[model samples]
Target chain A: MSHHIVEFKNVSFCYPDGTQALKDISFRITHGESVGIIGANGAGKSTLLMHLNGYLMPTSGTVNIGDVYLTKKTQQEIRRKVGIVFQNSDDQLFMPTVYEDVAFGPLNLGLDEAAVRERVDFALNLVNGLELKNKPPHHLSCGQKSAVAIASVIAMEPDILAMDEPAANLDPRSRRLLINLLKTFEHSKIIASHDLDLIMDVCRRCIVVRDGAVAADGPVMEILTDKTLLEENHLELPLSLQR
Target chain B: MTFDTQYYNIGFLDQLSYKDTFVHRLDPRVKLVVTLLFLFTVISFSKYEIFALVPFFLYPVLLMTLGEIPFMFILKKVLLVSPFAVFIGIFNPLLDSGQVFIFNGFTISAGWLSFISILIKFTLTVSTALLLIATTSFPGVCHALRRLKLPAIFVSQLLFLYRYLFVLMEETMRIVRARNMRSFGERGKDMRIYVRLAGTLFLRAVERAERIYHAMLSRGFQGDMPTLKHFQIKSGDVFFALSALALLFVFRFFPATEILGRFVQGVFL
Candidate 1:
């Protein structure tokens, strides 16, 4: 009954070219849960994450965000509740300045300028990106651009946060900063990443996807340590767990 | 320098707009309107009327100084585009044989005079356009367009084009670098490789566009990108616009450059 919960019931999606990206995928993410989705390339992890906010509607079955079902009509409302941070920070931060990019979502929601400004400041402050507000996205370092990308989404103040490969391109230091930043977020978080160590650090639960279906679902540490399961899905144990 | 570094720094004019100065502070709409008027006034004169257009150079010079934009940078950009204008005007002297003028006891063709006029107009208009962007951020200008009641879609397209120009250039730089590294000396930089690379870049751009669209949709983008109207037309905007028009009016009708020339002659002779 929690409004922040996300549930998928037998969801299946096929790309227009007839590639079945997600096959009968069902999962439930309750409030305050942090989950990591792991899979090999082309395993439909991204396609599945795209469903949370209805960026891609399930060709069959249903996705529920909080109290309402996700449909063409409810996607806009669902988007306000479920914020998505894409893998490429460049694609997400498209506006002229960091300030305008962070304000984009709130402005799209028809918020007034004062309200948008407040949200932008709060979100940028949360990610320590306030000083970068005037800089163009291109001018930002990869780490700064990623932080602003997160701020752009979180400015909507969504209940659930989903990110695709949030730490993929960061340096070790920037990756550490990202982990620390992610730890401060109390929203229900779903992350799809190849970084099992990041998953172990930030997410308590782990979902392993293979061939567009759930291969394993368990606690992060348990799944990350299962050498056979990880190997079967073309993954390896977290570096910390290798020895 | 490397290709990408050069490609990256080309947008330095855009960076210059972020600097705080008198020209940068004016409302973008005011600058845009006045610049259009200046361009129109410069091109309206007869092709032989070089003296009037000579004074028009002051506008870009004033803007460059006030905006703190590097004079040489704008001049370099102006020169970069000079070949196109030069090509178009080059045939004038050869085709119009009878038009001639006697200047300082040397016979000068009227075609030469007209070509010079074209060159002047070209410099004035192109440099002013560059200065306008150098002073006003592109988004500021796009917002001005929206405020002026231009189609919202057109403005949004311009905004995206400006923002993605760097993104596209970076993508091209990567592909070029990859090709360079793979090719031993200068092999892959050929036309055939370039044509194939263009196709690859186009496909990649299309994919990136899809992802960008998905990102926009996830953030509740309806159809149009709604820009917040925060630009207030302050008194300085009006004063700037009015004084610019007054100056343009005076220089347009009066040969200010010739008068200055005569004044210098009277003093120095």
Candidate 2:
């Protein structure tokens, strides 16, 4: 039996404005599983991922990450465990230099200066971005900035990596580079993206969301092969990948 | 698309990479103390003490030349921002009417010289402040402030504000450009449109701040920013402070400018 790294029990959330974003959603992700979350616009995809990182507390029910219940007290521990890379790299790379941004996480974790530097170098090398250490984020290309953003989070050495639209707004070459980089990570990943090709290629399991609920959850091949079900949920399989 | 082009501008030039020569690397506490002393010494002189004040210009000159900043750039920036100071100082001539030495056969009042003194003091103080920023990056200055035990919250806010200033300003400039491209001159300047434009920018900034907070929190930012490296004071910093104080003493007590002027006069006569 697979041990669950994250388990959401009947989780439901409403925005401060009383807008229902997620309704009684329940899911469990196992350790080392690459799960792709697919949904239409306003289908609660981002809301669900935000919960995994403790960015947003559930209005009802409980969220458990590795046996620790997520509350105000445990939010910090949960954040350290689950690193959520936002869609825009601009939000992630806020420091003056790339090295500083990458080192931010480890330094905050109370690691000594030498240890922070080591983690920063290791994280940058993981993304093949050791060359751009001294450069500021504003000076980097979009693809490079995205990689630096990933490095910034990876420096914390989080147990789970939750990425929202990881391949959004990238050229084919940059997208392929990002996918290749993602393939190198052994940590469990939950990727929410509209790029079905990347989803099918990188994720082992796929969860289709519709109207604040999980429409389908199964293996990537099973979901990708079901064209009717995908179209019904406003997600389409790429023509090349369709069989 | 590359954002590098946007980082190259007057603001970036003034804010970064101007060089931290021996003088620039002195402890900010020392520099701040010495700068205040320089200002007080220059301003405490009598109206007829023009010769004494002339030697004081050396401080700014050395800062410019040694710091590797262009003299003309500092001069231009100082002069451009000098009108208000000039206006305030101009009133001194009218307020105090006392006759002094005549220059070029024209009798100059003591009040005029004092007004001139005020102008010189203004230039020295403002230009030195600008040079301080030009030589030291804003972050370096903030770190110095933090080291001096200023309120941590205030210093941290200043650091955050400085870091985001460029980001927010660039965002604002993009919005202004978009507005300009879409509307004519007067239409672009309409109050209603301007208000809406500013409102949108504010909303965007707030949203950006929220996202930034989340990013910071995710990185284990527990209300404090921990630097990966620490700054240490070297022997050069001590030497730089001592030499600067020594120079200030020499210029204050001895009239070097007048001595040089007399030498030139004797040669000419």
Candidate 3:
């Protein structure tokens, strides 16, 4: 039996201002699968990620995570299961101190103080920056802040980690470090990024989104190696990885 | 961008220590209560009541010395913000014309003394406010305000405003820098350009706020933010608050300075 963790069926979303963000999106993410969604700027990658965590209820169809339908009643539970790290680390890390930011998710989950501290330590250790616990988020380097943002979600121990543009605007070394850290997570991952190199390096499954619909979905190597399809969809294969 | 010459960066202040010192360890409710009470007792004296108000200065002095804050820094901030208070209080002398004291055989009206009293009160109150913030962080004050039974929505709004103000302000500063670098002097501050700049900043801020709301909702923020840490009042807090209150009461009610004057007079005569 296949263990499907997230299922979005015929999902369509339109902003309150009448801008359609996602259209008839149907996708199934199985347990422990690493999926990357690649698209242009306005291709609705963020809107889809929001749907996974129940931040946005689909205007048309249904979303399910581990047999539970996404609804107002199941929002808290769904959010606990699906952790989202936003594109901007500054937005994700709002607390005064690093430790507080890491512990924020677990504390919101109503975990005990001891358990929260343990989770915070575990998360900080995962980022390999335990010494930055006392430092403020604004004082951190861009890479460290991004790592702390990931650690903040990781502290909650969510089953699914959905990140948007996890490696955008980073130095090559920082980008390498982020990819290495992301490689260690065993949970089901959904990464939305324009960085085809990082996405191809980590994700085995690739989904191409264009004009608010899924244009193509298949193995990463096959999808990434197709130059004509990429150009047609306003995407270019990275020069280093192209045939 | 030209770097800001202002000494205190709000970003730098946010990262400072939140530990329990002799000051930080105080109960928030007690601190709020005592600060208010101290302000009231200092302000209640008659206009010509300089002698009585002299003893009240000791509270701020003790707070500064014990809290290990710089006295000059607090005084400078108080003095810097004093002109408005002075502007209001100066009218007292012009309105109230009552003669009370004869200094060197020239009668001086009580109105001037009262105006002076206002000046003293303004200095003390403003300094105390600065000292309170200097010693206690903004989050600590918000927690204190929450414990003091202030409106939860307002307190949380204050906390949220402080959290995002830095983020938004930094963004604003960057935009201003970019604009300035591209434009000449008059064009930089032009009305049309200013409106466009502000409009763009507002749009960015709204987008940021929307993202922040979603981020907050995902973390189980159901209208109220729950703080993980709890504050407990200790014996030191009680003793400190009570002793300060008792001292304020005695100073307000008794003519301790008059008695000291009498003793000095007796010694000199």
Candidate 4:
């Protein structure tokens, strides 16, 4: 059986303003593999993540999840298979309370209230965030907000998790907690972040994109060690790997 | 970070709503109807009828005491927003200077009496509105509106506005703080910088809404926000509504305060 769970088959995307955000991006993510995507600020990392769950349909080409090509008809199932966490916790945690935010996915899936409650509780407990269930998202500290955001997505139990800038704006303790939580997720992950230390700690393989196209794809250590590639892609070796 | 973020109390009323009390436990629809009726009765009084408005205060006072809400907090909040109503009412005494009442050889202008009535109405209406939210959650109010056959779009917009009010205020406060820090006493406080700051805030809000939409789409949101919790009206709700309506009827048609005052004077004499 093929281990691949996500495949980008020459997928290209363009914004409504005629800017080509992704240029025939092709890649495969095997099940349970964690990959780090490194790129410059506007190098299309987020656009690529958006395509995984069919939020933005490709201008050309196809995105397949478990051999099912992404289409309007299959979009529902595709979303269940892949969950994307945006960079900002505020954007993701839109519901009034943490419990409601976590239950949002399951309730939308038409699950019974009891089942939704169970899932929300489970997810919150998994993230050590059960105590935050009734608190409003706005009242939470920055770290708690990020944790609730992740729990909200995790409650859906998606097969693939894609996180954008998972560690940005988080203090050290929260970042460490996030890294440990991500490690516990038993699914394929694509983390696009500028936090090089986070990528090294959680990802074994790395992909570098420059100017809307893939610059390099190799083992994490090999890519981080290569000074020429790191500088070219607006990245650097993680602090742990320095010297 | 002294972000001047004192507006964090935007949800303080919401927190009060979660407390378990007889007022909070009543169905939101019942509370909504009673509050509206109370407001109507209070406003229906004549311009110079201050005695009739005295009895109307019982409804809000009952709610505050039953709901365990602090009277001082409600008073402070009411005072904060009273300036607008006070400004409008202040003109009544100034514009209309006709004598209406005589007490102990002193004459009071009809305009002053009307001005006092305006202040009374303002106190009753604003306090009732605040207490309604304090006892009934915002979602509860939105759910009641939806059940009352209000347009889904209107209720959802209200829900969104209430939910995001905190987020937007915090963001605005942060921007203002940054502006304050970078500029000297009067450097960046001009109207030009204010306009540009507002323009940037507007763009940021648009971008934030787009991201929120994307997040919703990824989670199976299809056109509507579905709520799992359902509301059912119970006998307690019906009883509460009936008693409130009875109070309104008695207070509206009967001069309870004037009769009580006359009885007190007769007994003393």
Find the candidate with the highest lDDT and give its number. 1
- The 10-residue segment of model 4 chain A with minimum total lDDT is A1-10
lDDT of 3 at A109: 84
Clashing pairs in 3: none
Tens digits of per-residue lDDT, candidate 2, B1-269, equal 13335445456554444355765676666666666677777777775466677777888888788878887877777887899888887877787788776667778777788778778778888887776767766666766777778777887788777667777878878887787789986766788888998899999999999999988888888776666546666787777778878887888888788788899999999
Q: Which structure among the candidates has the greatest DockQ?
A: 1
The alpha-carbon deviation from the true structure for residue A119 of candidate 2, after best TM-score superposition, in angstroms, is 0.5
For each candidate, report its DockQ versus the true two-chain complex. 0.81, 0.72, 0.60, 0.66
Q: Which of candidates 1 and 4 reaches a greater DockQ?
A: 1
Model 1 shows how many backbone clashes? 1
The digit string of per-residue lDDT tens for model 4 on B109-208 reads 7888888999999999999999999999887888788888888788778877877878888789878988989999998899999999999899999999
Tens-digit lDDT string for candidate 3 (A171-236): 899899899989989999999998999988899999999989999999999999999889888899
| After superposition, candidate 4 runs with Cα above 4 Å error | A1-4, B1-6, B94-107, B232-239
- Tens-place lDDT per residue, model 1, B149-216, is 99888988998898899999989988888887899976666899989999999999999999999999
Locate the minimum summed-lDDT window of 10 residues in model 1 chain A: A1-10
Off by over 4 Å in 2: A1-4, B1-8, B14-51, B94-105, B109-111, B263-269
The alpha-carbon lDDT assigned to residue B145 of candidate 3 equals 86
True contacts kept of 4: 0.62
Which of candidates 2 and 3 is the stronger one according to DockQ? 2
TM-score of the first chain of model 1: 0.98
Model 2 lDDT, residue B226, Cα: 63
lDDT of 1 by residue, A1-243 (tens): 377889999999999999999999999999989999999999999999899998889999999989789998988899899999999999998888899899889999888888998999999999999999888888889999999999999999999999999998899998999999899899999999999999999999999999999999899988998999999999999998877
